[model samples]
Target chain A: MKILIFIFLFLIGPLTFGQEALNIIFQPKFETENLVINKTYLFKTDTLKINSFKCYITNLKYYKNDSLVHVSRKRAHLIDATDSSTYYISEHKFFRFDELRFNIGVDSLTNVSGVYEGDLDPSKGMYWTWQSGYINFKLDGTSSRCPGRKNKFYWHIGGYLPPFNTLRKVSLKLNKSHPRQIYIQLNKLFEEIDVSEVYNVMSPSDKAIRISNKLQLLFKQVP
Target chain B: MKKTKLLFTLSIFALLSFDIIKNTYFFNPPQYFPQPTYDFQKNPLDSNKIELGRLLFYDPLLSANNSVSCASCHSPFNAFAHTDHDLSHGIFDSIGNRNAPALFNLAWQKSFMWDGAVNHLDMQALAPITHPSEMGSTINDVIEKLNASEEYKTLFFIAFQDSIINTSKILKSLSQFQLTLVSASAKYDQVMLGKDVFSDQEKNGHQLFKKNCAICHTEPLFSNFKFETNALPVDPSLNDLGRYSITQNPEDKNKFKVPSLRNLSYTYPYMHDGRFATLKEAIDHYTSNIENSDRLSPALKLPIKLTSNEKVDLIAFLLTLNDKEFVFNKKHQFKKISIETKE
Candidate 1:
């Protein structure tokens, strides 16, 4: 009887005390097509090969007309374009929300804090080892349009300092009629950024702060 | 009634567990020292964990080529700062950009690196382990090597009951060992604690130090740890702009983290670029050689003036900051692992 009760509580605990995974899905796309490694696509009459794209999505929260509703505290979701399994956000209980918000990078508190496991781990390639901060957005690819050696470009954007604090909060409004989906449009980013002149952005700087703004616009409520 | 009884039992168990952890290892600083900034509750100190960290500190497996260890640059004998080379050397005889600073009293430090680039002590090792001219290895690669090593598996199990090695475990273990390096047993500390008295020359030197250098190199820790301009001209060869490289702020140009003055004798070849070789040269640079710059510390716009005799007196007081007991401690030295190895 005791064993049965323990099992029952374990099953129902999350549902009773929030933090149960939501049905919403995060989809990564390039214009109309799905993003996948080993796939080459045309970017302004040049073949562009996306080697990798990963980002940190943190501080997921929901609100209804400015009233506090739900918050997924002390957790950061590491999203990788190559890994389709990482696209899901383990969300809290959601009855209804008018405003959906999340941060594009790790918070300053978590960045200054010590080692973490799983998604926030230093081994994840998302955290910059040379400097202390999580790489909020990482995108590396090679394109014929890029003038660098082998036509490669890498952008690792992160900083916790002022004037270059790359952590950006993304806010999107939710309509009750729309499907529970968030689309991360990579094409919108490529459309604005010049590939040849702006190749490398490895550290936190004025350029990183600008690129971080462009990354913020990538996420949108979809379907 | 049953729930109350269960809660009472759990509270008792939690108290006992807390007692065991507290008794395992206690990091006690001198009474005058400030509380350590490191959150001990998160990564509690255990003797086994600290021992594992000490072994890892000396292990060359942290390097990509396995030829250079952390001790290659940060030797235990030299107050954990290399005395052989001014600039740090890494695998394949690669040279690093800046001088390897001494590592002691790290728990009280707010940030790591000369530029204050690294914010936490646990994350500080990652910079060297992955820097191209340093160990030239990744956290994942080092962890893979540790997981494959038979000896590490046993040691890790002893440290943290689980044998599976990960990044957090490795970093926390390293931090646990470094946090134990508290340099508060110097003669200066003894004098402060009413156990000893300073000589007349040393006493005069201490007073002079308080007047001239004490603003930045505060007593107790002997460093404010804030990024400040020492007005040393940038070395043209390296073209290192110090904190400006990290912050990109023009005001922060030619600035470096104020290093602690504790254990100065063992950690010589002083300054950020290791330009000054001896105590006299470093002191001379401060007194007469300070170049005027807009970003210079307001107090140092006019270089300090000191007679040759007063300089000698100040040097005597500075020598008292050297913690001989810490440098010679057997516990901080490298150990020959007695665990059976498969390799």
Candidate 2:
């Protein structure tokens, strides 16, 4: 009887103590509808087909009662909407998080801090070869609204420098009474996007900053 | 027994001190120069790492085709500046958009590239290594290539203690080698140190430089490293907007980083585009051919009225900035290692 009790306690102890993994699920959406890559989606009056969508989510922080409680061990993560593996955050400690905060791009320190492994690796194709600095947000696709060659629009937004710093801060208040997953609505981002005028923003420019501002309104708590 | 214990302690102390000295690499800049902006404490320089970087810099294996190396464009004999071509020629004889600037006194520079595109020295090599026209290879490709080589594996083990060839180690080691390229042994530096004196023409030219050029090309470093439009007309073909391309501000249009005046003789074809092949032409442009523009440097707005003799005197003074010791330093040369023997 004593041995059985000890075994039961040991089995439950590991589960009770810091073993619950907090999962943050990122679901790409277009307003009320689900977003599927390579499929034509009617956005406003123009038809658009997103071939790829990737962005670096960095400096994740968790808060309880408006006070900072937990922080992610990983400094940065490259999330691909197409890959479900890239959308979940399971490495962080379990916390009854009331609010979550993160940046949309790599910070200035990380930009100049040589190279890093994992998502920050240069092999990720998110890094600029002509200049230094990671592309904070990359949105590439073909839009009928675009007047450029092949009707293709590519927006690679990033700049860590002053006056043109494109790193955006996103804070979402989690409804503890509801589900834990955070849904990143892609429709809200494209609502204000005019593909024709600002199609090819490959570098840190005024257009990149403008697009980055639109990207800031992409997160919301989902039930 | 007490004496033996004291001796043991002293020996241990000596060994510890030796270890400390070995780890702390010092940057021996001239007394007149400002403190370096690079925080060496973050990535402490080690001799092994520098050796690895030197090998990497000379090795063309970093390129996709293994045909172009950093030294191909930045030759040590030419003060690390490519002089044969106006624009840098890279893999497959592809011409680059800008001239390859001389590599020296990099520890003091706030930014890299003429347009200040690269923010850090460690990040500078990525631009060339991955550029389509340059080395034309990714960082991962370079690492894989280096990892496969037995010589590099040994070198990496020696340098980083871990034989794993990662981007951090590669970039940091490259920086360690470049940070050591100091060009402070010129006649100008000697004059500053009171070790030598300039001739009459050189002296006159120095005074003129102080009055006219010293605002942008500041003393000691020979540059403030700020972006300025030196009145050169924009080449319609290249259409290089300089700083404006990075910042997208109309105010920054045509503004290029002020280059150092050191090694002026070896690093010919001056300016960002390498439009001027000779110092005389550069001087002539400054004196006569400064096209008026809204974004032109305020200092150059007023015409630089210099007589032909004054130009000659200025050129003579500029020549004093040349450092043959730096250009000919065998320490910066390619190490003649027999890969066959090592293999």
Candidate 3:
């Protein structure tokens, strides 16, 4: 009985010490409610419906204690609110992390590199045809406040060139030893955007840089 | 002895295979040309991919209404430039702001478009397909259309060894075809290669060109590919600020890319706005109508003084740049394979 117990303990010890999978869940929301595409909702005293929302999240970095430990091998990820597959991270193996760092859009190097597959695919509709860079964030919808045809509003923000680069960095501190989820509030973003005057922002301009700055405020850590 | 013989045979086989691969993927630029800036190592050249891109270039299915293709604005007959219109016309007869420039020797170019908006050659096609006045189609929609066709599925399979129709394959194929357009068969090229001799009049014109124009329009390729203000007065109606729109720097105001002087006979009217219809008019503008400005090119600051005889001789020298073999290359032409026949 003593020899059998010793054998069991030796085999189970290494399994416990091995690397465990860390899951990071991203929940996109409009205020307190879940975001549903094409559903009408009241935003800033105006009726609006979001038809599409897609953006690239890239260069994920992991921190242990106060030092940087590991960075994601994969360069970028295309996240669409409509796609459930994009809501979680399951590939990286990590037991614990104290801080997480990532960028909201593709970096300058990836923008100039020609024709990438998967998340950076041109067929994803996040790339600009008239220019060389990818559209970092795309937000399309219809609001009663807009004066354009069919009351449509479109904002495609992305630029890698100096003075107009819209790529933003985000850093979040984990409260618990291991965080399971992160929340991005869309209502806070909608409150700042005025659809009536600035309805269209398709090119790399001053307007795109302004809206990208506002988008950075919407990300928060969920307890 | 048997083991040694086997090793010798294997080594010979490996050497032959390596030679075949090298010939298949070589870029083969002219001896006088500078090294191409395009990183061919990233997307290696393959004949199958080039053939696939040729098909895509001539296919009208890439457009939203299935009426416009890349060849619509960039015809092969005119050195891949559209003629009969000052400004390019797109789907639904919508007019674009700028003239569609001739396409060739793209591997040597660092930037594309008149404004230099696109920084890479592979990404240049995306602009026309998605522009509202152009094809008016999304890359996703084009992929969906390509995937539905049995012909494209087989071609994609042959080119990539995978039947999946994706954007990366589509773009890489296009780049492969465009990079193969090397305009090295011109009379000017023949003279440089010591195969042909220029006439005495042409020789005189060449000397004049070197003295007056070679600073911006450099030798061999005939373009430095830098943005410079040619001193054309800004058209108040068009309000085109040229490179200023892209860079937003005050110094870059009214600067436009120095276009290659090759194929001047086929690619006209000249300039960014297509304001000059004839080479004589273009020469006249450079000598007399240069609007003085701080942003103008230093080479052109002192107005070029050309005699009437010098102008005629200069035009004669420019005509030597016309490469008929390149213009009429059947491989670059539209492949008329019917959808039913292809399937």
User: What DockQ, on C-alphas, does every prediction get?
Assistant: 0.84, 0.49, 0.69
Candidate 1 residue-wise lDDT, B57-167, digit = tens: 999999998988888888877899988578988988998878899999899888899998889999999999999899999998999999898778877876776888999
Better of 2 and 3 by DockQ: 3
lDDT of 2 by residue, A111-214 (tens): 98766778997778888867788999988898898998999999899888877689999988877665367777876766777788889998887888899888
The TM-score measured for candidate 1 stands at: 0.91
Q: Which stretches of candidate 3 lie over 4 Å from their true place?
A: A1-20, A43-48, A142-151, A191-198, B1-26, B336-343
For model 3, give the TM-score of chain B.
Answer: 0.91
Summarize candidate 2's per-residue lDDT along B203-294 as a digit string, tens digits.
Answer: 99999999889889998999999999998888998999898887778899999999999998899899998999999888888888888888
Per-residue lDDT tens digits for candidate 3, residues A86-202, read 877664466567787889999999888888998998878898777688999888899999887899999899999988999999888888843767777877767887888878999
Residue B276 of model 3 has an lDDT of 84
Where does candidate 2 stray beyond 4 Å?
Answer: A1-19, A29-49, A112-114, A143-148, A177-179, A194-198, B1-26, B338-343
Model 3 TM-score?
A: 0.88
lDDT of 1 by residue, A1-223 (tens): 9999999999998878856556556788877888887588886776888899898988887788887687865488898987898887655455567777889999899999889998899888988887888999988998888999989998888897898899999888887765467888887878778887787989888788878889877987775
Tens digit of lDDT per residue, candidate 3, span B1-343?
A: 6776576446535534543344234468778999888998887776667778888898888889999989998899998888756888899999988888998888999999988888888888888988889999988899899999977886776667688988888888888888887787899999999999999889989999998999999988899999999888888878898898887788989899999999888989988888888899999999999877888899988879999999989888999999999999997888764322221
* Number of the top DockQ candidate: 1
Candidate 3: clashing pairs of residues? A129-B126, A129-B127, A130-B127
Q: Provide the lDDT at B7 for model 3.
A: 67
Q: Give native contacts recovered, as a fraction, per prediction.
A: 0.90, 0.55, 0.93
